[model samples]
Target: MPDPTPETSAGRSLLLVLHDVAPHTWPDYQPFVEAVDALGNIPITWLVVPDFHKRDSLAFAPGLRSMLDRRLQRGDELVLHGYYHADDSPPPRSVRDYFMRRIYTHEGEFYSLDQGVALERLHAGITLFQRFDWPLAGFVAPAWLMSEGTRQALRSLPLKYTSDPQYLYQLPQFTPISAPGLVCSARSAWRRGLSRLACELQAARLSQAPVIRLGLHPVDMRHGFTRRYWMCTLQQLLAQGRTPMTKSAWLSTRQAG
Candidate 1:
């Protein structure tokens, strides 16, 4: 008979969350939604749109408000990804931009802005999500970039959590937890392509945490090569009987743990 243990249970279940809902490109999300619905054990947090159309070309669908209503009624959580889902106005003028700006940058250039500015920007985002009657479980910076100010601002806010690959914990206060192991990128290199999938699978196999999060993007699924690789990663996790959880659920579990 198998031993009934908490770690065993934790290893069997993990969270798989999605980001960027009702983004400027809804067409890009259809395949992702279809594949996820088919996958069946996952939950997604529809990070709602704020204002960007008036300021830029990016905006959410006109019908997105209703669609979000349905998802929330069906028991999905909403998070405030960002106001414009972009960095602040009069964008940074340097090889190294601030943390929030770096969120969308391909290269990780380290720079930071004051905490007060960070708080005000975050407040704007929070107010936007409130308009739709969506309770934000946490704030995920556009590209997971965060700085000292960002962290301090979040701690001062009323949010329940904040998630980044680097920091996994509950909000108002962050408590670091062991990741168990690293999650490799399938597209890191030609050699990494073949081996990264195997590496992630092995990590899942040995994990003691209740949920394993693999942050993914719709853009990744849009690419043929990346799509195939991600599908395999999902399959490997599913094979281990790991359940995909939304961002809120995943963070909640860690906090409780």
Candidate 2:
């Protein structure tokens, strides 16, 4: 296959990434995979948590590993999510921090980590992926939140990229890819409604962009509201000539140009 030319309209990339992927979340993710498969053998990215919340580790999940292996064989990409998808930071110092840490996001594993801690967690997550020999090219923090220290640590790693809610950063130099992600919120009825609306707006807004990102979560798959919404969103974007590709693949083409 020829490499995509990012400068052209035909090369606008659609990055559909599954978050919080682990053995414990496998069942929740099945519907999502099936839905995407319904659209043909479209490629997707799996943001895998090596040990979610420090409890559900991939080591004990042979079944999930088998499933992931098949996904990779079919062209899906695996990315290292935070080591322990749970946040271990101390109490927030202000109201703004509290809302971001405990309300807006339940857990931002890399949100407060300095370089030393971030590197340690990154190494631990990489070790788990290596144990299974899963090829990992990217690292995305849970909740799309990472500190400057985490960015500093990632610079020294061999990772291809990392992302926040608003941008995908190429590793080492951290070159910014300007595309805010579309994510679902199952926290409440209002949040869900608002999220769907925001998704539509973001999708339309990015119609001419070089890249468009859709971040799917376990909770989003379990609910019918978000599940159907995303499937339709996928259809709409595909109709607009969006070529779904893994984040690493997108970067490859971007650099190839």
In terms of lDDT, the best-performing candidate is 2
> Mind giving the per-residue lDDT tens digits that candidate 1 earns over 1-257?
12222332243455555555544545566676678668764666665546543343223344766766776776677777655555444566675564435444532211253688778878887876675677777777665666788888888999887666644556665655433323444344664465556656666565655556665555555556666666676777787777666666655565465
lDDT for every model?
0.59, 0.84
> How do all models score by TM-score?
0.74, 0.92
Identify the candidate with maximal TM-score: 2
Residue-level lDDT of model 2, residues 1-257, one tens digit each, is 12322253337778888998989888988877887898887899999988888889889899999999999999999999888888898878889888889987767988888999999999988888898889988998988788889989999999888878877777788777665678888768898999998888877777778878888889887788988998888888888877899888887877777
Question: Residue 13 CA error for candidate 2 (Å)?
Answer: 1.9
- Model 2, total clashes: 0
TM-score of 2: 0.92
RMSD (Å) of each candidate, 1 decimal: 6.0, 3.8
lDDT of 2 at 26: 86
Per-residue lDDT value at 53 in model 1: 30
